[model samples]
Target: MKQFWIVGLGLLPLVAGCSLFETNPVPPSPALTGVSAQDAAWKDQIKRVRGAEEARFEPLVEAREAVSAALAQQGVNDYDAASLEEAQQALDAAESGWAEVANKRRPNGDKLAAIATDAHRATRLAEIARYAAVREINLEKLVAVNDQLETREQSQPTRQARPVTGDARDLVGQKVVPDQLGEVSFQPGTARMKPASQEIVRQLAGLLERYPSVGVAVFGHTDNVGPSAASLERFVKANPKLEQQAPSQAEKVRAFNLALSAARARTVAQLLVDNGVPARRIGARGFGDTRPVASNDTQAGRQANRRIEAVIVPGPDSPEAQRARAENAGS
Candidate 1:
C-alpha cells in the first residue's frame, strides 16, 4: 500500500506538467500570436464582424418567423431543416466575404479599419440575403401546399343532382350583409363565440335558409399594435399581461382592445354555427391583424379595423367552394 501511494504521488507531477504544457502549446498561425498589438486589432476586427453579423442575423430571425407563420397558414408545421440550411448558407457567404477583407491586409491603419468595417457590413448583408432567399423558397412551398389542398378538394365526390326546390337550392347564391347581423363579441382571446353574437348568427341562419348553396367565410381582423408574430402569439395565448417590467395603463388598454378584436371574430363564427349554419358552409379564418380594412394609427381606425366580415360566396356548386368543402371533409 505504501509503494502504491508513492507511485501515485510520483505520477501527479507528470500529469500536472503535461496539462501545463498542453495549455501553453505554441500557436501555429502568425495571425494568432505574432504581435500583441496586431492580435488585439485582429480580435477587434473579428468582434466588429461578429457584432455586425449578429445585427444582421437578428432581422433574419424575424424574417424567418414571418415566413414560418405564412407557411403555417398554409399548413406547414416544421421548417427546421430549411431554416438550418439557410443559416449555414448565410454563414458560408459571410465567411467568404470576410476572407476577401482578410486577404487585403493593408499597412495603413485607417484603411485596415475601413476594410474591417466593410467586411462586417458585407457579412451582415450576406445573412440578410440568405434570409430573403429562404423566405422566397418558403413562400413557394406554401403556395404549393395551397395548390395541393385545392387539388385534393376538387377531386371530392359531388352531389349527383342539384335539388331544385329544397334548402340546398335556396343557398346557391346570396350576399352577406354585415349590418343585418350586429355587434358580435367573443370571450376575450378565445375562438368561442359569445351569446351576444347569437343574433347575428340567427341572421346568418336565415341567410342560409334563403340561399342554401351560399357559403360564408367568417374573417377575423385585429388592430396592428405589435409585431405580426407577437400579435398572433398573443391571440393564441388568450391572456393579457404587461408589455414590459411594469404594467403600463396604456399597454393594458391596448391588450384588452386587441383581445376584444380577436374575440369578435370567434364569437361571430360560433354564433353562426349555433344558429343552424352548417359547420361546413361556415369557414372560420383569423387574419390576426394582417388585413386591416381601416388604419390602425388612431382609436377610431383601430375600432374599425377590429371587425368580423362574413364574405359570402357561391356554395358547394361553385368550383372553389366545392373544392374547399371536399378538402375539409376529407381532412
Candidate 2:
C-alpha cells in the first residue's frame, strides 16, 4: 500500500516549482541620475539651503563666542560637558531640519526658496535666543557669587571699620544733560565757536580735570522756528542760511542757531579730551530748539536763550562740584 501512495509525489513537486516561479518580482522605480531635471532641481534647492545656512553662521559664531566669554567671566568652570552637549544638540537639530526640507520635492521652487530664506533667518534668531539664555544663566551665577562675596565682606572686620557715607549719589542713567544756557549763535550759521564763548569751554575743562571719576554730559539746544524734522536735518548738515532767503524764515534761522549750539558742545568736549581727560568721561548730545530757557519771540529773551552751558558732574568726593563752588565764591 505504501508503494502505491508515492505515485503522485512527482506531480506535487512540479506544482511547487510552478508556484515559486509565479511569485511577483519587485518593479524598479526610476533611477536617480545626476543629469536628470529632477536632480538639477534638487541641486538648486541644496544650493539655496547651503547658501542661507552659510550666511547665518557668522552671527551664530559671534553669539556663541559672547556666551562662552560670559560663562568664563562668571566662573562657570564645570560647564564644559554641558556646554558641548547643548551645542551638539543644537547642531543636530538644525542639520536634521535642513535635511528634511532638502529631501522634499516641491512643485513651486520659488516657494521653497522663500522658505529656505526664512529658515535661515529662523536659525539666526534661534542662535541669538540660545546665546541669550547662556548669558542669562551665567549672569545669574555671577550675581549669586557676588551676593555671597558681599555677605562675607559685610561680616568681616574691615567692613565694620570703614564707615559708610550717608549722602545720596547723583547717578544719571544715560540722560542728556542740557546746557545751562539754551543755545549758541554763530552769525546765523557756522561751525566756529564764538571768541567770547571760548572762555566758557576753558572753564568747563578746568572743572572736569578736578574729578577723574565723574562723567560730564554736554548737550546742545536751539530755538523752535521750523518743521522739527527738517530743522534737525539742516542742523546736522550745518549749512549756513542763504542770504537770498528772508532772516524771518524761522526754520532756516533756527537751523543755523542749533547748528552753532551743537558745534559749541563738540568743541567743549574735544577741548576736555585733549587736556588729558579720558574720552569715556564725557558724552555729547544735541537737542535742536526742543528746550528753550527764554521766550524766542523777544530779541533780548532769544539772545539770552542762545547760549552754551557746561554741566560739571561731581566725582566720588565731588571735587569738581567743590571747585566750581569755590570759583563761584571767589567770583
Candidate 3:
C-alpha cells in the first residue's frame, strides 16, 4: 500500500506538468463556432414567420415549439429522439452534428447549413399550412368546398416559364428568397468560386431572370493579411516595384487588395450575365480590406472577410440607390 501511494504521488507532478503544457488542445467545434450568427438569424426569421401567420397548424406549431425548446438546450438532446414534427428537425440535427464533431465522428458544418435552410423552409410551411387548414365548417364540408377551388386553381395560368417582363413587381416578389442569403465566398487569394458559391450564383442568376426589375449588387472584400504602414520610410520600401517614391507600401497593398476584390466581383457579375440575368441589372464593386464583418485573425474569420457580398437592390423607382442604379447599371 505504501509503494502504491508513493508511485501515485510521484505521477501527480507529471500529470500537472502535462496539463500545464497543453494549450487549447481541444478547440470548440468549428461547426457550432462558425454558425452562431446564422442560428440567431434563423431564430429571428422563424419568429417573424410565426407572427405573420393568420393561425398556426398543430404539427407545425408543435415542431416550432420543439425546435425552440431544442435550441434552448431542452426537449430532445444528443441522447434522445429529439425530433420535431416539422422543419426544425434540421435544428436538432444541427445540435447532434456538433456532438458528432466533438467525438471527431463527423463534420457538422454542411449538415447544419442544410438544416438551417430546412428550418427556414419549415417556417414558411408552418405559415402556409395554418391558412390552408382553416375552415368555416366541419372537415367534410371544407373538403367539398375546396375540391372545386383546387380544380380552378389547377386551370389558372401557372407562374412557370414567366417571361422577365411579366408584372415586374410580382416577378421581383416571386424570386426565391433563400434562407440566410448572401454568405457566399471564395478560396484564399483566388477569384475561383467555392463549389457552394457556384450553386448560389446559379440560383441568383435564375432569380434575376425571373425578376428583371430586381437588380443585384455584389461587393468583394479581402482579409487584412498584407503590408501595413507603421512608419513612412518602411511604407515606401514595401512597394519596392513602384517607381513613384512617395507611394507608401500600404497604398500599394490597398490597391492590390482592391484589384483582387474587383476581379472576384467581376467574375460573379459575368457569371450572372452568362446565366441569363441582364447585365444592365447588376452592379459589382470591391471595397478591398477596408470593410470586414468578422476578424481577420482566424481561418474562418479570414474566409468570411474574403467574400463576395451580394445584395438584392431595390427597384429603379425606390429612393434608396436610385441614382447609383441609374448611373452604374452593371457597367
Candidate 4:
C-alpha cells in the first residue's frame, strides 16, 4: 500500500493540474525611466572617464576642468571669444578621442598622443582666455574712473584768466617732458626725490601756482631693469598678452617698475602740493616701461626712459585759453 502511494505521488506531476514540474518564466525587467535612466547614463560616463584616467589620459580631465573654469569666469567669451572657441574645440576633440579609446579593448598609442597634445593646447587656451577677460574688465574700470574725473573737472566753477609768463608759458599749452625741464631724479630705486630733482619740481609748482585753474597730470616712467621672480610671475599671470608678445625680462620688468614709477609720480605731486600747488589740480600716474622715449638697450636711453612728465591742461578760463581768445579777438 505504501509503494502504491509513492507511485501515485510520482504520477501526480504528470497530471494536468500539477505545477511542480513546470518552470515559471521571469517577469520582464521594468523599463528604466526618469531618474533611473539618467543615473544609468551617468554611471556609464563615469566608467568611461575612469577607464580614460587609468589609461594615463589625465590631461584630458584637466583640460575639461580648465575649459569649464574659463567659461565660469565673467566676460571670458566677450573678451577672448576666439581663444575660448578654439579651446572648446580642442577639448571636444580630446574628449572624442578619449571616448574612442575607452570603447576599444586596446587604445592606440598614436591616438593617445594626439589626445594629449589637444588637451595641452586646450588648457593653455583656456588659461589665456581667463587672463584676457580679467584684464579687459580692469581696463574698463580704469576708463570709468577717468570719465568720473572728467565729470568732476567740468563741475568746477569758472575763474578769471591770469597772466602767463616764463616757465609757465612753456608748460601751460603742452605735455611737459621732465627731461626737457632738468630731469627729475630719484634716489637709486627709492621713490624719494633727489636734491637735483628739486629744481624741476619747483619749476612745475611755480607754473601750477601762477595758473590755479590749470590742472596738471604727472606721469612717471621707468626702464626695463630689475624685477623679482615672483613679481614677474604675477605680471605674466595678470597680462597674458604681454607674455605672449614679449616673453623676455623686458616685459616682465614692468611689474616692478610700475609700482616704483607710481611712487615717484606721487612724490613729485606731493612736492608740488608742499610748494603751494593745490592737490586738487594734480593727478599722478605711472607708465612703467611701456612708453619709452628711447630704447632700453642703452644706458642713456634707459636714463631717458626713467623720468617724470607733467601735462598741463588749461581750463576754459585759464591763462593759456585766455591768450588764445585774446589773439583771436585781435585777429
Candidate 1's displacement at residue 293, Å, is 2.2
Q: Which segments of model 1 are wrong by more than 4 Å? A: 1-180, 186-196, 225-264, 317-331
* Candidate 3 residue lDDT tens string, 162-217: 33344444333222322234456666656777888778889888766665445655
lDDT of 1 by residue, 53-82 (tens): 332222223334433443433222232334
lDDT for each residue of candidate 4 in 165-252, tens digit (9 for 90 to 100): 5553343434454424657889866798889788788987876666665656577889888656775677577777766876667546
User: Which regions of candidate 3 are displaced past 4 Å?
Assistant: 1-179, 227-246, 315-331
**What TM-score, to 2 decimals, does candidate 2 have?**
0.36
User: How many steric overlaps are in each model, in order?
Assistant: 8, 3, 0, 0
lDDT for model 4, please: 0.62
Cα deviation at 35, candidate 1, in Å, is 85
Model 3's C-alpha root-mean-square deviation from the true structure amounts to: 28.1
Model 2, runs deviating above 4 Å: 1-188, 225-260, 314-331
User: Candidate 3 overall Cα lDDT vs. reference?
Assistant: 0.48
Provide the TM-score for each candidate, comma-separated.
0.36, 0.36, 0.38, 0.41
Best TM-score among the predictions, by candidate number: 4
Candidate 3 backbone collisions, by pair: none
Lowest lDDT block of 10, candidate 1: 12-21
lDDT of each: 0.45, 0.42, 0.48, 0.62
Error of 3 at 68 (Å): 63
